[model samples]
Every structure is written in C-alpha cells, then in structure tokens.
Target: MNGGLIMKEVTNSDPFTIVGTEQYNMVSKMNREYRIFVSKPSEKPPASGYPVIYLLDGNSIFGTVVEAIRIQSKRPEKTGIVPAIVVGIGYPTEAPFSPHRFYDYTMAQTDQEMPFKPDGKPWPKQGGASEFLSFIEEELKPKIHQTLKVDSNKQTIFGHSLGGLFVLYTLFTSPRSFQSYIAGSPSLHWNERNILAKERSFMARLEREAIHAKLLIGIGELEKEHKSNIGELAKKMSERLSFYKNRGLNVKFIQFEDECHTSVLPPLINKSLRFSLHSQVDQ
Candidate 1:
C-alpha cells in the first residue's frame, strides 16, 4: 500500500488524543500533516504562557516523551521542567514520506554507496535544508504560536539520527530560531563531516560573540556501528566542544555507557528536558 494509505489506516486504528488533557490532534496544512500533543496546566493558561518542545520523528517518540513529562510534572520539585506542549512531526511509513523532511534530514547527495544502504538508491534527496528550515520558521511556528499559549522565548527543537543532523543545520544557519537544541546520536558523518566544517565557519564568523542558547549532545557509548571511525567522531566532537566553550555557549554532552542507537532516545529526551527546564529557573 502507499504511504498515505498506511497512515490513514494507522490513524483509524489508533486515533490521536491527549492523554491527560483535552487537547491534541493530527493537524493538516498545505498538504502536510503533523501530530500535535499538548499538556496544559490544570488551573488554566498562565499569564506568562508555557514552553514548547518540537520533536522530529514524533510518531515514534511522542508516547515516551509524554510519559516522561507526566512523571516529571508529578514531582513538586520538578514541576518547572514539564513543558506545555510536545509537538511531534509525524512521518509516513514509506520512502520519501515527507519530501521536505527527506531532503532536510540528509546531507549533500553523494555518488559513493552508503554503509546503511547497500543497494544504493542515489543517496536519498537532500540539500534543501534551508528551505525546510524556512517551512518550519515561516509556516509551522506561526501556527503553533497562534493556537497555543506558548512562551515565545522558550521554544526548543530536538532530533535524532538524521533528524539530529538537521537540528545542527538549524543551529548554525538560524541560531536564533530555538532557545535550546537537543541532538541525540546525530549523524555527524553526514557529508563527510560537513556539519563540523560548518560549525567551524559559524564560530569563525562570530568570534567571542556569545550565542545565548543551550545545546545538549548525547551518544551511546556502545554505538560502534562503524567501528574504525568511532575515534574520529569522538575527536571531532571534542574539537566542537572546545570551540563552543571558547565562544561561551552553554553546552552539555552525555555518553550513555549501556545504550545503543535505538536505546538512546528515552534517556536523551529525559536529560534534554531536564536541562532545558532547569535553565528556565536559572534565568
């Protein structure tokens, strides 16, 4: 079956709904559909409004994220960490699910075969990230702002794997777009470490100028998929860390010793939310 048909069937089987609150749904605009999950305070919308966390690959991670929020909000001491809304950009279960995402998440197309794809399908469309970023900034953000009681300055963006790569893209290209960024197991190998090069360029262009935002990067200690290249990745990350520190950017790195690529999401999400939440209090 086609991807759209599969999505329709899945939605029919298990419709979207907010678990604890009376708000949530699959929103559609301009041929794109997204699953938005919201969690509002019991009293009502606060005068200051709530913060939002936008998660890429929402269909896979929304439940775990929502559960984490529920557990965090129950604790009196941790109430500050729970965000008001967790928007998940749902993806169809097929090739080129969303042309925008497929393009944005990938790096530049290459002629060489990928380690993950042995059959070699022309490197999956990529390099339209600037335009994809525009879609979120110009289209999606406005929709959320108008519909929800969100604190304009407290928005965060998160991603994993290829999605994580795009998070970095946004961070460098549009640093002011999000107050915080969470990247879990990002594919730093994209475009032969083009992300690292871009970071260098960004730092060079803004030397000694502080970027007022929080960045958290996490990786599984046991993620040895490309064993020979692991040391290089660590070295690149270390270099980036030094650069960010010199620039006075708020940053954190976590290495989960027992986790793998797929296993890193839950803990990463928990830690990222905790960090973002605490930063709010510190401000």
Candidate 2:
C-alpha cells in the first residue's frame, strides 16, 4: 500500500444547469432505473398551470433543450413563446446512450424485421415500447404531478431517431396521454414498419372515440440519401397521418434542408416548443 494515500468518494456535480432545475432517480416497474431532470419556469405559472415537455435521450441533449428554453422563454413577449417546464428522461449511465434503447424504443419485431447483427451474431431481444409507455403514464407522470403544478392537458413529448419511433408508438396506442407529440427523424422502418399496423388500429379506435392532439413530424433533408429506407417510411407516415387531420388532429410535416440527422435536433426542439406554446398564447 502507498503511504499517505487517502481514498474518499468523489462528489460529482451535474455538468448542465438550468434555473429552477431538479434532479431525481426513478425505478420503473420493469426494474430499470432512470435519471430524470426537470426545470420549471422562472416566472410564476399561469392560471392554467405550467405546460410540461417530456423529452427522451435526455442524457445527451438535456442541456441544449433546457438552454433553449431559458434563452427564448425568459421573455415570451419578444419570442412569442410561453415559459414552461422541461422534463428530461434519461438512463443512469456514463455513456450518452445505452443499447437498452433498442428494446425500450421499439415494438415487437416481425419475421421480416428480424434484426441481423453486423458480425452475424445473435439478434438482440427487442420490443418494450408498450411497457415503457406505461412507466411514463402511470408512474412518472404522477410523481411529477406531486412536485409541480402541471397543466395535464398541455403536456407534450419529444424524441429523436429510435426515441422518435417510441413517440409515434405512444401517440398511436394512447393518443390522449399528451397534447402534442414531436418526432424528429423517427426510425419508421423499425419492425418492418409494424407501426403501420398500429396506425390502422389507432384509426379504428378513433372511429369509436374522438382524439385531440397535435403532431409535428420533421426530418433532416440530408437524411434521405443517408438513411435510404427513411425516405419511403417518412412518406408512408406522412400519408397515414394526413388522414387524421379532419378527425380532430393538427398535423405538420417539415424537412430541415440544411441539417442532417445529428444537426437537426436543435431546430426540432425549438420548433416543438413553439408549436406547443405559441398558439396557446394567441388563443
């Protein structure tokens, strides 16, 4: 043993900070632990309560989303956007991502969608979007409600790529869970486009009951050639979503010409915030 060596636990501080931010840990029913970061508005909440945005992939982009909210939302009069709370949901890991995302974000795989490993290794087990949605709706939301005054009717959720795929899954399976859903470059080819089946089911349900939600879908133009399958998938999703416009839904599709999959995220966050809060202010 080395002499004069004192070993003690090191207390690490969060690298990202937003005013009025709070951090917590939650364990889901599936036995997965999550890292949750939340930031409420600096100003007093409106009579309607603070709108909340639930974001996936929070491990990597929480700071950027929170920062954007802080800069533009500080003065809503100037920005035409209202102040709201941001809730980032991430996994408890040092890395920016986890392979758990593959299972958590994707639904059941079909025979045609059987994943082939790069080295011809065994395929990874997948399909947990349903249970993950339950964790959000049943456990996570209630926990947040206990701490903050949330306008439940104005809730929104945002995700990108695989997480984006989960957002679409959530909207189709439980349309009333949130007021707005934003998917940025969703992996529409997931499970061999099984989400299309979910879409048909969603439509059937909509026939019996009314649905009220706003959906904003955006993709990076450069991703077309880079993600060849996405071109067809996005087109299909666009067409399917368009059918719901007259059935009490607001749908918008945008392509960010200059941005690629990686670079398009900031604009997606900014645009989602505006889409959720701007029109509400005017109304």
Off by over 4 Å in 1: 1-17, 20-43, 76-80, 92-100, 110-116, 228-235, 246-248, 280-283
Q: Please give the RMSD to the true structure for each candidate, in Å.
A: 7.9, 6.3
**TM-scores, one per candidate:** 0.79, 0.89
> Which tens-of-lDDT digit does each residue in 127-205 have in candidate 1?
7666666767887788778877888778889988778878877887678899888878777776555676677777775
Winning model by TM-score: 2
In candidate 2, stretches whose alpha carbon ends up further than 4 angstroms from where it belongs are 1-16, 119-124, 280-283
- Report lDDT (CA) for all predictions: 0.68, 0.83
Clashes of each: 0, 0
Model 2 agreement with the true structure over 172-216: per-residue lDDT tens digits: 989999999998888887754588888888888877877889888
